[model samples]
Target: MDLRIEQAGDRPAIAEVHRSGFGGEHGRTVADLVDALRRDDPGALSLVAVEKREVVGHIMFSRSLLDAPRRLVEVVSLSPLAVRPAWQGRGIGTALVREGLRRVGERGVPLVFLEGDPAYYSRLGFVAAGGEGFRKPSLRIPDVAFQVVRLPAAEPWMTGTFVYSQTFWDYDCVGLR
Candidate 1:
């Protein structure tokens, strides 16, 4: 498959991809997508993978804060990663994640967080953020679900409630307002 990944500007397409990937009652909407793209952090990256001009996968990241003891540090949050069912497990999702991390890393940002399976995210160098000073993205979810990665020269910083933007609330993230 000739797969190419790029920064996603097509919000409607991304919403469609997410709804298809999750197959849940809470479907994605253009409003949620617009809020995502327009967030304070807007993510370290928003990526879409295309095969033959059709988007088969989509991933978005945005800025959030890692409230540490002394200061608030910038954190890139990986969320709502989606891949069309037919294209999943074929490395499209992995490609998006690896590339997203690469792009974020190049920007000199030091921390990244996500609420997901450790087994999966650990494959991408993400580990429990608690040790380094960032809590799970929400209090309603199990703590184990959140993880973080700190880049070179940054200390394993803090552990507190992650302060994601209002966009996360609008998008129906696990459990907080």
Candidate 2:
């Protein structure tokens, strides 16, 4: 298995993987989120897992904010992590995430946040953001799933509300269209 930055030509396969990984209507919405981010978020970092020369998994990190009353801190948001159904359980998604976070850290990002399963993300160093004083930007996200992980150079006390990009709200919001 090889992991690398996603290229222009990898979009369709990445979308397919998202669709297959998540399934049904939710899958399509996730895939659409990927596309929207790619088109609208110039700062978004996308990575893919390739095996035998085929794209099988993908992950994205996009610019978000930590909206403290005193400051607006730039952070990255991880979303729509996908490994094809056939590729699940193979660590492809893990590889993509680890590598993606590494690259994001190298760029001087201090924090990363996501809304996901604690059981899964905690192993990856994510903890409940609420406990860390990072408030949820929207009431829509459940407290349990809202997580944050600090980068190598992060200030552990960098507390604030997570502000996701409009692209995230636009694509992921249900019943808002």
Candidate 3:
């Protein structure tokens, strides 16, 4: 499998991965969120895994704000990671995440946040953001699911509320209803 930055041609396949991974209406919602992020967040980072020239997995990290006491800091939020059901157990999702993190960190992002299963993300170096002195943007997001991973650029003073980009709010995808 090949891992690389997502290209324009990859969008459709990426959407299919989300649809297959999430299924039903939730899958469509997540797929729509990916499209909106691509349109609105210029700084957003998106990656994909391709096997046999077909996209098998995708992950996205969008620009977010850390309302720190000292000053506003730029961060990222990982959302709606998806892998085609056929590729689910082959570590395609993990490869996309690891590559995404490495690339985002290279861009000097201090922290990466996401709302996901603790059991899944914990293995990927994420910890409860709330326990790490960060606050979630919404109460609807459970404490356990709001996770963060600090990169080398992170500072001790960078603790604060993580605010997702407006597209997230516009799509009403900030947290579970």
By TM-score, the best candidate is: 3
lDDT of 1 at 165: 63
Put down candidate 2 lDDT per residue, 1-177, tens digits, no spaces: 988889989988998998899889988998998888888888899999999999999999998999876688899999879898887998887888899989999999999999888998998899998998989877777888899989976775688788888988787642222
Q: Model 2 off-target regions past 4 Å?
A: 173-177
Which runs in model 1 stand beyond 4 Å of their true positions?
1-9, 29-31, 39-44, 158-160
Evaluated with lDDT, which candidate comes out highest?
A: 3
Residue 126 in candidate 2, Cα distance off native in Å? 0.6
Give the runs in model 3 whose Cα sits over 4 Å from its true position. none
Alpha-carbon error at 173 in model 2, in Å? 4.2
Whole-model lDDT per candidate? 0.70, 0.86, 0.93
Clashes of each: 7, 0, 0
The TM-score obtained by model 3 is: 0.97
lDDT for 5 (candidate 1): 40
Better of 1 and 2 by lDDT: 2
Which of candidates 1 and 3 is the stronger one according to TM-score? Answer: 3
- Comparing 1 and 2 on TM-score, the stronger one: 2
lDDT of 1 at 145: 76
Put down candidate 3 lDDT per residue, 69-129, tens digits, no spaces.
Answer: 9999999999879999988888888888899999999999999999999998899999999
